[model samples]
Target: MNKKLCLGAFMRPISLHTAWWRHPNAAPQANFDFPIIKDLVRKLEDACFDAVFLADHLAVMNMPTNALKRSGTITSFEPLTLLSALAACTTNIGLIATGTTSYEEPYLTARRFASLDHLSSGRAGWNIVTTVNTEAAYNFGLESARLHAERYERAGEFFKVVTGLWDGWADDALLMDKESGIFFDPEKIKPLNHKGKYFSVKGPLNIARPVQGWPVIALAGASDAARQMAAESADLVFGNARTIETARSFYKDVKTRAIAAGRNPDHLKILPANQVYVAATREEAYRKKQVMDDLVHVDSNLPNLSLKLGVDVSGFDLDKPLPDIPETEQSKGHQREWIALAQREGLTVRELAKRAAGSGIGEMIGTPSEVADQMEEWLLTEACDGFMMVFHSAPDGYDDFTSMVVPELQRRGLFRTRYEGGTLRDTIGLPRPDSRVD
Candidate 1:
């Protein structure tokens, strides 16, 4: 049997490019426009993409004023709200929303995802994240962001509480028996009674068991703590690897960890993010990328760089090489990546920040066949199960990918040409989790 690829569309923020809104053909205010998002989701489903992944932000003040002013991501619909609405519009594509464990209540988060699973008929996925933005702390009434390890620690306990709540009732617990006047079998239901360090969510969620037992658990991050969490819990891991070598290393490390944790490696899918720019020709693709990169202002990149490194780079001279920097409370995985890029490429602070702003996991620029070649190579090499595709611009980039690249992949027998099942777990070949009530 041939290996198959799982593709996800990064829908929220509309585009990862800082200057996405500035593109000449880009849809104005596309991030906040439901019609545009609906259209995009429809396109993704029509092409048989696995999921529409929506990333959320707790604060708009993550960057400096000048940078924040130019950002296209400043205003957007909340992930759950938008995913719930999209659930109504899209039947095939999985709805995956980021729900931060640090700031949100486990009961509320579990209930919302369970409701989404029911609404979408078992097509919901929750991308578990610990909020990283320092400004987000202020919005949640925290004086400062919690340390990275502490956040992950809380996240681990939080997952237990939420999943425990999800298992409140047996799969066959519910029965609408009018004659007996019993809505459910009393003996089949169980309460979690969870008492963890960070949260004490007493179990039995108000809603019935989610359609897929618990909505598919998705996680993202490349740190040691993150890898451990993903190994033990995540059904899907959104990776950030720019090279095949790096990707393969990450792939082996996490899968090995998952195996050690008594999980089948096949159950966890690693999908690195890729910003694709496919056009009629390779040159045209590069030209399109250059145009987008040219629109980004240098001032807008400083705060973004700082956010990733968890240290202020504003004092560093732009023309000089990056100074020896000490890691702080930010994502060690991201901070390490940036430092390595700078040292490896001999890039000055200015050049490094610009490149970082342009593409994080790296861009796939070429014609449909060319882009498909890279994807096929990654999948065949076991570097990743698939990709979380990031479009450079709306409508144009979105259309080109669905119409061009998807068919080429389909022709190569690397991607699914049609839907195989109704639910997300079924669609992705992930097993439906058994109810933990008993």
Candidate 2:
């Protein structure tokens, strides 16, 4: 069978741009408005997007005090709560919410997703994250962030426990025998006496098996430890690649790891985050991107970038190349990618900062056909299985893709014109996992 492209909408209340809310067409208050979110999901569903991925942070993104206030990164609805509301309004589009293993308990996470899966009629997905922000530690009563290695270790065990809890009941456990007054088969239910290095979860999950067996597990981590976790568990891998070569490398590496883990590589879909600006003409699209680019306050972003990279680039001259600094322990994956990007392009501080301020991933600035062509090229080259599109503006950016690029991809038979199945797993071509209770 030919591979059809899998598209997911990477949604935040605001765009990747710091000044996105200040855009003339942007709705600055959309983050607090459910009606607007509802509209966005409806449009994505209409566009035949496979899922709407909602990224969450337990605390405001740690940035300079002024920058935090200037940026819209701080304020947003809780992901699970928002997704639950969205599930009530949409029929087929998958609702993927980020849940962190670092801060949340396995049993609670399991229950929330199970309920979401049932609420969305099996269209739910969980984007497992080991929350990265150090400030979040304080909120959870810790003084500092967990070590990266330890976090991923906890995450691996967390995944095991959650999936085990999801498998608490066999698919046939719920008989609902009305005449006999038997609610379920006790023999078919099992408790997960999961004791691991990081967690001890004893359960028969309160909820029955999710409609799709387990809600689809979506993971994003670029580290070796992260890759191994994805290989062992993830159905979808949200990748970060700035170029096709890099993307292909990541795709091959993860698939190889999956095979080594005794799983079929085809079951793991690699979807890189794609930033696109589409217009009627290529010139128009570039103009649209420039408008957002012009709004960027480079100085405001420097402190944040410095903190992220683990070396202060703020003192360096804007036109000078980055000084060789050791990678930070904060985010090894991002540190490696940012440095590679700078070295590859010989970018100056100003140029790199500008790039950081904009969407920091594979980007396409083109007309509808041009964008479609690029997407097709990437898919055919095996650079990625699909794309998780991050729009420049909400509703408007989303409107443009669905109106322009979606049709072009459909015309080329690279994307679906309608949803293929009821559950997200089915729509994404993943098999329903058998219950692991036995």
Which lDDT values do the candidates have, in the order given?
A: 0.89, 0.87
Q: After superposition, how far is residue 276 of candidate 2 from its true place, in Å?
A: 0.7
lDDT, model 2, position 420: 72
lDDT of 1 by residue, 113-177 (tens): 99999999999999999997778999989899989889999999999889888888899998899
List residue ranges in candidate 1 displaced over 4 A: none
Backbone steric clashes in candidate 2, count: 0
Backbone clash count for every predicted candidate, in the order shown: 0, 0
The TM-score of predicted model 1 comes to: 0.98
Model 2 segments beyond 4 Å from truth?
none
* TM-score for all models, in order of appearance: 0.98, 0.97
Residue 297 in candidate 1 has what lDDT?
A: 85
